[model samples]
Target chain A: MRTLKFLLRKEFRQIFRDKSILAMIFIMPTVQLIIMPLAANYEVKNIQLAVVDRDHSSYSQQLIAKIGASGYFRIVADPRSFRDALRLVEGNRADLVMEIPAGFERNLVREGAQNLALSVDAINGTKAGLGAAYLTRIIGDFNTDVRLEWVEPGRFNPMATIEVTSLNWFNPRAEYRFFMVPAILVLLLTLVGGFLSALNIVREKEIGTIEQINVSPIRKWQFILGKMIPFWVLGLIVFTIGLTIARVVYGIIPAGSLLTLYVFAAVYLVALLGFGLLISTFSDTQIQAMFVAFFFIMIFILMSGLFTSIDSMPVWARTIAYLTPVTHFIEVMRMIVLKGSGLADVSRQLLYEGLFAVVLNGWAILNYRKTT
Target chain B: MPLWAKTGKTMGAVTVTNLTKTYEKGSVTALDDVSFRVEAGELFGLIGPDGAGKSTLFRILTTLLTADRGTAGVDGFDVVKDYRKIRNTVGYMPGRFSLYQDLTVEENLNFFATLFGTTIRENYHLVKDIYEQIEPFKDRRAGKLSGGMKQKLALCCALIHKPTVLFLDEPTTGVDVVSRREFWTMLNRLKEQGITILVSTPYMDEAVLCERIALIQTGRILSIDTPDAIVRGYPDRLFAARTDDLPRALADLRANPSVRSTYAFGEYLHLAFRQNDTENVSGLSRYLAEKGHSGIEIKPVTPTIEDRFIDLMTRETTPS
Candidate 1:
């Protein structure tokens, strides 16, 4: 215990003395939190539309007005023919074009069916795919409106349809920031904690100070723990910085208890630091350790369900996502922060993180050798 | 002189028997069939060139490395099995400066003290003589200190634990001459306190400072004895020769069938003959003059440890 105390003291003194470490601890978290969420905005808005109404009927006008009123689209041009609307799309002024064929109201009344043509610019694939889907759904709703207005009780029998009124529970209107903020917090903590611990040990090795430590009477566990605790404390400081940015800059508040969030974060840091130290034990230089840490952290971030939902992935991909500790923490972070879940609600994920902490730390400590 | 006792008596502070180590699957032999011993309170030197495996032997004894094929012990503790005890009882300063560069001098000292489960306050007396010289620069980071101060700080850090044996590998390799002399003086002082010190160096002059030394080359121990004994074992009478043109004189001397060996030592060439006597020694002056060398001089000189070292090295290198 006395040995650990001195080691921690020495480690902390060096950490605070280093200019690069200080900059990484304070500046990196703030800049990443502010810039990443604003730039990573994925919600597509203000889609451009061109209209070609050949029939000039009130039905076509009403349809155009409804598309604009849905708040997803902006009608940029109204042309008399399909060729003119195609010009608008080709000129890049419109994202997609919608054309109503001639005699659309007469055909709809006589045959009860009509064809609506849609031409979308496919260069931006996501924008084009979503725009086409959105236009199709709006036209379907318009058709239902027309049938309700013109149907007579005795003239035609109408079949009942089911409707779903979706009540968004955690995030009303599903703001993207609430979902991204919690995960970003996890990413920043993992980066600061893992990198400092790994590079710190490898720096000692490269400078030949590790030989002195190896010959000393310090126990393996004491030395490893001494390395771990200082970086763990710095990681928490970075985490707090990210949270303040989320709360003040992004206005994201945790719906669950802060105590539970900290509990999960504390365990997650242990698992992550263990992983970093393991890489250091294998590597002899700081550059090698940094590269190894980057490979694993990149996998962790991608597989953590931070950018994409895990439920939509294939069986193999989902298995990989479940295996990483970050995935479990991200799930628990989203549950606790956005869903206002209590500790009891996320007990399964908590248990998994705890298991990861034990296994990774135990493996690293055993692999660290003082005699070789 | 051995102090005879500080706390307890032991057979040998360190003992190694037929130790062997190689790198890259026996392709590069670092230490081949080496063995030696250091009595308690004795200052022993491992003198050789840079790659003579002195550092490897020190590492093995310090428990930082394991020898592949022999038994070694430090302070009566086995280096392989009782390594923990050896680590606790021995102090090692590697050839390179290994103190934390970013840490202050005092902090590095305190850190190593606590690492061995002791405090600077408890063991301050052991390192007092060495540490006092460096105490004024306690606030300075170790990297910013001069080369000499760095070695002093390194020595203090190694001594803070107050172990039974101290291992210093090439501690004077890069130090200035005055600092090197001062360092050896400090070692003698530490020896007076009954600490067994094992020091290695490439400088032959430092060999006489230790009570005994083992001259090594190419991972082999050529000779191990007191410096006086090793010098007395010189086989043939040696002569120092110099002329206006020294290189030509060396070549001319080598051309003689009776000349056994000749090599430059500073401004003069030291020559050892197969059949050495006063008549041949005086006749060498006329021989150099006949070879067209001017201002020729020849005289018999007492052999130093280095003279014997070179003689042994040449004898082993040239095939019988």
Candidate 2:
């Protein structure tokens, strides 16, 4: 225990010596949490739409009114030609176009069928797809209303439609910021936890100080744990600052117990520190360590689904995502903050992260050498 | 009682036998079948060049590394089996400045002391003599200290544990001459306290200070003995010769059949004559004069440890 204390104190002293590191640990996460979520909403609104109304009929005007009333699209241009409608879309003035054929009212009355063409710029695929779907649903509702009015008065309607009332169980209204702030916290913890420990040990090796420790009475485990504990604490401190900012500034609080978050965070920190140690053991220079760490952190953060939904990913990618500690932690964090999930709800994720912590730390300790 | 104290021994000795270490799967032999022992309370020096495996041997004895095939003990404890005991009983100052550089000098000293399961106050006497030098700068970061002060801090840290044996690997290689002298003085004082010291250096001049020395080259021990004995054992009579035109004179002398070995030693060239060459001094001087050499002087000189080292190395490689 004394050995462990000594080691932990040494680590703490080294970390506190660098003031820039302190700022990075405490300040960077708050900025990311505040900025990223505000910019990342999935709901598409105020879409610029162009219309080619060749029919010039009452039915076409009514259909346009229905789309405008939905508040999802705005009729920015009324182009007389198809060419102008395409030009509006190509010039970036409009995102979607609607065209009503010349005989649209006559066809519906004489042949009981009519064609309405909708075109969308699919470059921003998600926004474009949502716009198209909203337009189609609005047009469908308008057509049903016209059919209902034309039917005999006071007749009973027999057709039924299934309605899905999406509750958005955890995050009602799907506030992107609430979902994103906790994930950013996890990312910040990983950045400080993994990169700092790796750079610290590799710096010692580069400066020839590792030789001094190897020859000391200190054991290998003592030295490694001593190096890891300070960074682990730093990780926690960053996580706490992030949580505080989320609560005070954004009115976001964990739905689950804060204690559960901390317990799992501790486990994830071990995994991160072990990963850093493993990198340090293989790298002989600080620059190499930084690059290697950057590579792994990039892969881990991207695959962890901090910015995207893992369920939307392909089957193979989802399988690979399960291997990342960050992925599991992000899920647990979101579950706690949004779902107010208890221990049972997050047990599977916690178990995986805990297992990662043990296996990685064991490997790191085993591979570490007391001598060069 | 502590295991070392329970033994009731006053000093520590190290024994290494058939010690071999191969790196990169037997392609590089850092140490090959090396064997030696340092007596209790004696100062033993291992002298070698950069890759001669002096550091490797020191590490093995310090229990930082295990030899591929050998049985070694420090202070009666097996290096492999009783590594923790050996670590507790030995003080090692590595070849580089390795203390926490961000910490103050005093903090580094205190930290290392605490690591050895003791305090600076308990072992203050062992390190007091050296720690006093850096005590004024106790609050200064170790990185901010000068090379000399850093060396003092390292010594203080190493001695704070009050170990029975002290191992220093090339401790004075980059230190200034004054600090080097001061470091040796500290080692001498520690030796007085009846501590066995094993120091390694590439500098041949330091060989004289050790009670016994091992001259190693290419991972092999060329000879191990007292400096004086090693010098005395030099078989050939050596002569230092210089002329008005020294370089041309050296060239002319090398061309002469009577000279066996020639190397530049500072301003003069140390030359060894063939054993069978019966030519008198005048004959060699006349030969130089005839070759347009002037103001030539030749005198017999005693061999230094470096001289003995060169001679031994030359003889070992030359076919009989």
Candidate 3:
């Protein structure tokens, strides 16, 4: 324990003495939290839309007006004939073309039905798909209104109607920022724990100081813990700053106790830093350790249920997702922060992280040899 | 010294038996069937140039590396099995300056002391003489210190633990002359403290400072003895020859029928005469004059360790 104290003192001294690393630890995370949420939004809006209307009838005009009023599109072209409308679509002046047949009004009164054609440009598939869906919904609503106006007092109804209303819980409007902010917090902590400890011993090796330590009487565990504890404390400090940014910049205060969130964070850092040290033990240089840490951390973030729902993944992917600590931490963070969940709600995740802490750190300590 | 001479007493400070190591699947032999021992409290030097396997031998004895073939023990602890005890009982200063460069001198010293479960204050007497020289610059980063000060700081850290045996590999390789002299003086002081010192060096002059030395070359020990004894082992009588033109004189001496071998030492040429020829001064003077060399002078001279080393190396490479 005495040996550990001195080692920790040296580590903290070196870390703080390097001005660039200090800035990276404290300032960079705050900037990334504020900007990443604003830039990473996946919700698409303000689509550039064009429409071609062939018939000048009141119904056709009303349909065009309804499409314009839905707040998702802009009409850039209106042609007089079906051939002209098709030309508008071909020339990139229009995204959708609506053509009412020549006998449209006569057929609706006499035969009680009419045919309309819609042509859409599907080059940008996602934009075209969303635009087309919106236009279809508007036309369906217009048809329903017409049918309702046609019904007389003795006319038969279409059938019993069932309407579905969705209420998005937790994030009521489903703002992508709320989902993104918490996950970005996870990434920030990961960068702190992974890179710092990964480069610690290998840096000593490169600079030739590891030879002195290797010849000393220090226990392998003492050396490993000395490198880990300072970074562990630094990781928590960075995490606290990230949470402050989440609360102040994004107004995302946690619903559950901060105590529970920190408890999980502390254990998760041990597992992560342990993995980093394991890489350091196997690598002979700092560059090798950094690249290895990057490979694993990238996989951890991608497979963690942050950007995509784990349940939506295939069986093999889900199995791999369960192996990463980031996945479990993200699950716990959302539960406690968004849902106001209590201890019982996150106990399973706590157990998993605790086990990971033991296994990874244990393996690291065992693999670290005093002799080679 | 015979291995059995010290066996009945406390085990020698360090011992090795037929130790052999190779790199790249036995393609490069670093140490080939090597064995030696250093008596307790003796100042032993492993004298050789760079790549002479000095660093490799030191590493194996310090318990940082495992030998592939034989066994080595330090302070009565097996290097492989009892490494932890050996680590505590022995101090090693590697060939490279291995102290933390970014750390202050005081901090680096204190750190090594703390690692051995002691404080600098407790072991101040052991390193006081050396540490005091650089103590005024205690706050300076080790990387910024001069080459001499760096060597002193490294020695201070190595002695902080007061180990039974100290291993210093080429501690003066790049140090200045004044610092090298001061370093040897400090080693002598350490010897008075009853610490066994195993030091390696490439400088031939440094060999005489040690109580005994093993002259190493190409991973083999050519001779092990006192410096005077090794110098006395030079096989043939030698003469120092000089002329106004040295290169021509050297070539002329090698061509002479009376000369057996010749080598150029710093300002003069060292020559050996054939056993059958008499080496009168006029016979050599007349020969040089006939060869177009002027102001020629030749005289008998004593051999040094370097001359003996060159002799052994030439004889080893050349078949009889």
The per-prediction i-RMS, to one decimal, reads 0.9, 1.9, 0.9
lDDT of each: 0.89, 0.86, 0.86
lDDT value for model 3: 0.86
Which segments of candidate 2 are over 4 A away from where they belong?
A40-165, A369-372, B1-12, B242-256, B276-298
Q: Which regions of candidate 1 fall more than 4 Å away from where they truly are? A: A45-128, A131-165, B1-10, B239-264, B267-271, B274-302
- Model 1, A276-366: lDDT tens per residue? 8889989999999999999999998998899989999999999999989999988989999899899899889888888988998888888
For residues A96-202, could you state the per-residue lDDT of candidate 3 as single tens digits?
A: 66666666666766687888777778886776787778777887898887777676867766688888899989989898988888888888888888888889888
- Lowest lDDT 10-mer window, candidate 1 chain B? B1-10
Cα deviation at B172, candidate 1, in Å, is 1.6
Model 2 CAPRI quality: acceptable
Expressed between 0 and 1, the share of native interface contacts present in candidate 3 is 0.88
Candidate 1's error at A325, in angstroms? 0.7
Query: What's the ranking of the predictions by DockQ, best on top?
Result: 3, 1, 2
lDDT of 2 by residue, B186-244 (tens): 89999999999999999988899999999887778889899899999988888889998
Q: Pull out the clashing pairs in model 1.
A: none
